[model samples]
Target: MTESLATTVRVEMVRGRARFIELRAGTFLSPRPLNVEGPFARLALVGRYATLLAGDDLRVEIDVGSGVRLELVEPSGTVAYDAQGGSASWSASVRVGVGAQLIWRAAPFVITAGADIRRHTRIELADGARALLSETIVLGRAYEDGGGPLRATMQVYSNTMPLLVEDLDLRNTAHRDLPGIIGRNRTLASVLLVGARPAKACGEHETLLAGAGALARALAPHAHEAQAAVDASWERWSELVEGRAV
Candidate 1:
């Protein structure tokens, strides 16, 4: 007789203009090959979620399973400068991206949340030339009022410096209801941004997100337009917070 094992895998990346995130459980990513065998059931899995804000300019891929395969591809943009006898001027605009993926499974249930951010800008001119961007998201059926006990998070990244990464593992839904984690909230969310946004803009963004109350309400009766709202929320949190990366 042999004892079988399960595995979980996660791969994430953040850079100049592209990002990719992926994860899968039931197969716990481990040194030993992940193989789970049960008398009545057997489980196997793999997948990924990627976002390319720059179409035709950036590409990324994630092949997830008991084994994880993560990749990112980005086509750089340009910055030009010119001189006109007495004065010189320069202007540039670059678009970046932020992405994430969460894999949830039951029977021992596994929950994972992944995310990434990438963007850049250049300007050689005026006194108050400015730009801004951000991302945020709250996941749950706040409207229909649904809740769950499942929780987990996995994220990874690398750049010129040491590299930023976050692996958040949440457990005990009842615990999350404590005084800190989520307080009395039943929503899960993340936000990212670029440049700077006015206080009014920030306030408005949050107000708009009030509609994500129900996962079903999040969905557009006409079509699945909730993605737009979800995306908006995620970007709002993109705002940089002073803290150590986890």
Candidate 2:
């Protein structure tokens, strides 16, 4: 039997506070919301198929209502195993309402040797919404040759204006060494901050010649940088919304 998982989470403002109002998970998928003392709530993923298998399909959807703040975290990394002649896929879709904020700190996604996979991320934000997101992709396991084909796509938009869009199709390890591409790097890290305008400070696309730990180190500073940008944008937007600034 082919394995599949689907999880959905929704956050909304209740009595002037953000709370998780709805959460659902399918087979082999688990979503746990941790009790952290702050305006932002943390969500952890616990599952049996964090490492996907052949013919596996996984989907995650998250929605943040107006004035809500939420953070998402993965306890561990996700690995795509060799599917022999088959393939696997994982996708996530996020929606942020007006005046909402989201911080998604994703763990590394490793493509093991001989694995064929496709990953996609789509985020839509309303006017006055802000988000800080990060992702890391590792080509293969440590001390081993790289993996098989991996096609990844990402699209971020605010209302109708496109903030960022990327479509990468990597067939094999050779593609990683190509100039202007990964350039002999096995890991690729990306951090995006979307708000009033595109956060150009966080718009850096560089390949990293390091492992997952190094990627995390590289992402930490960028995450903070992105948060700062988002905060600034929020202040500006608030001023405009309140008619204090033209």
Candidate 3:
């Protein structure tokens, strides 16, 4: 049977405190907000299909009201199972209101052998809004030689101006043999910060694969390493923002 999941989360300022105005999950998706001491609200995912199967379609939407701060986390990583000639897709759309802040530290998504998947992310930030997002993708399981095809895209905008746009397609054989494009690496990771002035650091848009601590570090790197990098990045970003605000 084909499975589908859709989740929508909305947060707004209520009397100077950020509150979840709307939180809904459909079908096989579950949203669990964490109770932690922080300036931002944190959320986690809990459900069966968190490890997606063939013919699964998952959609996630998030909205942050003006002046609210929100953080999203995926406790466990997602793995795409072998489809046996079937396919799956996952998409996320996020909108941040003026002066709102958002940080999404996503877990690694692995595509096992024989799986076929399509993933896309679209984000729109209102004037004065700020956001930091991270994503990691692994081609196959540890010690696995091959996996199915995957096409991923990301589009981010600040108000009406585009901030970042990317498209990546990887398939068996081509993904492994192509030099400068994953090469022998099976993992790819990226971090994006929007609503900030373009920096000369690495240009306005940057995509790095197999760098320090990256999956390229070893022949078959554990997914936890990638997740740790993402989490650390987010923590550093939050500290930077806090320091700036002070």
**TM-score for each of the candidates:** 0.27, 0.78, 0.83
The models' CA-based lDDT, in order, is 0.24, 0.68, 0.70
- Among all windows of 10 consecutive residues in model 3, the one with the lowest summed lDDT is 210-219
Q: Number of the top candidate by lDDT? A: 3
Model 1: weakest 10-residue lDDT segment is: 103-112
lDDT of 1 by residue, 19-43 (tens): 2232323211212123322211122
Tens digit per residue, CA lDDT, model 3, 1-246? 365657888888877777888888855567888853334677876655555677788888899888878888887888888888888888899999988888776777888988899999998989788787777788888868656898888877777666767787775556466766655666666666666532222322333322111111222255565455445444445554343621
> How do all the candidates rank in terms of lDDT, highest first?
3, 2, 1
Look at candidate 3 and tell me the lDDT of residue 138.
84
Predicted structure 2: lDDT: 0.68
Candidate 2 lDDT tens digits, 51-113: 578888878889999977787878887888888888888898999898887877677788888
lDDT of 3: 0.70
Candidate 2: Cα lDDT at 186 = 65
Using TM-score as the measure, what is the rank order of every candidate, best first? 3, 2, 1
